[model samples]
Target chain A: MSHDHDHDNELDPFAARVRALETILTQKGLIDPAAIDVIVDTYETKIGPRNGAKVVAKAWVDPDFATWLKRDATAAIGSLGYTGRQGEHMQAVFNAADTHNLVVCTLCSCYPWSVLGLPPVWYKAPPYRSRAVIDPRGVLEEFGLTLPATTKIRVWDSTAELRYLVVPMRPKGTEDWSEERLADLVTRDAMIGTGLARVPA
Target chain B: MNRREANSHAAMLPAGVDAPVFAEPWQATAFAMTVALHDKGLFSWSEWADALSAEVKRPGAASDGHDYYEHWLAALEKLLSAKGVAGKGDVDALAAAWERAAHATPHGKPVLLQNDPSPTEGRGGRIG
Candidate 1:
């Protein structure tokens, strides 16, 4: 669909502005609205954290792949065909018994969209960006996750050139679960280190 | 789109696990426009980042971050202006023209640039 999707009576000013810009660009032959729709469609329904979930799920079951993910995330993720923009460089941070990793972009919302889809609104907001670095443990607590006192919390700041994805530890009872089933437990927040994987009920 | 249609796209995820990347259609449109522009080699991501970082750090920005995409839209416009692809004045005129066209066009009909009440009304539609 074109920018005219804002057919509602109460159109946001930004919506009108964006439509205008698209129309102008289209007139100038600078950009294509169809290409934009394809991109929007891709991010909307095709690429998302579901891709990341599969990566994490495979890592949980395959030690070699997990090692490769640590050794060279871009190549390892590419091996699974999850390669794209904003994820040119990736580093998988594994949550272990004594270490937890959290990601933030202090300057901007530099998320690994190729794997994670678009970053959530809160992820781009000031609170999460600033506090994820300043008060990571408190932030995790606010997310209803309380790590042991001895476990070290490490925060990774993402940039345009490189991004980090947190590989959450598999839930205790999911040892026998299939990769697809394990992926069902990997929420987008889990990959961003804001939440932990869900345990089987 | 309504919440149901928005959430409908997240059918791949289990219950309570999905989050909408964009809160509004305009945000997604703005985002896709930027990516599309970048894909066409209008400007490098680094340049785009510089423009965005400037807007994000603008004085008197909102504290709650509800206006994050507003800044994003501003950055896109600024970047386009800087690249000489479209200037600020041009964007403003085009926006105004679209406002007029949207009002003039009948309901359920696509709002085309030609739908503007006056083709030569703004500096934008000089080609037609």
Candidate 2:
């Protein structure tokens, strides 16, 4: 007999069952709807990606600070007073002109929300997740990032306790740029090591 | 209790062991926020997604709302920590404050539920 699993990409039976259970809890009023709202809003708004931008900007302007960031990301970040829940221990890597870096939580989704915000659905997709660690260069290529054969590719897998971020090299011709302007060029992917910050004309 | 009664009672409890209408939707919100930040040049979309996807694919991952938020929060923390922008303590303190505020006004007005786009709406072109 053909089982329900034969269906393509549909919600699994277990998932449907869980959805049904959640519906009942919502109707029963055991959990407060407002509380849930608070949780969601807090991450979406009050917390922002500026913190991460600041880090990237600083690294670009100050080489010493960039070295400090890569060496002890947690303590250096703590100095900025941006610590908490999943960000207790952090590490930063620098992707230079000759090297490309990417981060993945192969085991789980560990990210830096205090600075970068929430994750996108594609990040949770299976194709990117499975191929990221196995062939970092291939995944980068799909994203239109081609690293030279000489460029070292480093991939960091996130754990429940430790999280990682990539600090892409500052683009050339930004020597006289202000911190804010430099920050404008720092993208979330640049920090995550998947891509580089684009330069403006 | 009879099997039918047990089944009915099971239905009485919330699905996924978390608030359904409120919780399940946050994942998309989190996804959008991250996407918006990336689009605004705060970070790259690929790296952000890679970090979070790893968490969702973890073994024994909780199929409930709590697991979702916990992982999302963890992802945010990891990203911030990696950039040397924030520390774990900062997040914990904020979470503690949130808990206190939540308890103080159990019946207070809803927050975080406003201005969310519909599921069908485009997520700022980050995801295909």
Give interface RMSD, every candidate, in order. 7.0, 17.5
**Residue A198, candidate 1: how far off, in angstroms?**
1.1
lDDT of each: 0.80, 0.56
**lDDT, residue B67, model 2:** 60
Cα lDDT tens digits, model 1, A1-201, are 335454533345687789878877887898788888888889999998899999999999999999999999999999999886632589999999999999988877888888899887667767677788878888777666778999999999987778899999999988899999999999888899977887777
Query: Residue by residue across B4-112, what tens digits does model 1's lDDT show?
Result: 3234322212222234666677888899988888777887776777788788877766655668889999999988887788788877777777777777888777776
DockQ of candidate 1 (2 decimals): 0.32
lDDT of 2 by residue, B1-128 (tens): 12321232122122321122223553444444444344445456556656665566677664332465446545755775676544554434333333333333324344211112221232211111
Clashing pairs in 1: none
Best by lDDT: 1
Where model 2 places Cα greater than 4 Å from the true spot, the runs are A1-35, B1-128
Chain B alone, TM-score, model 2: 0.54
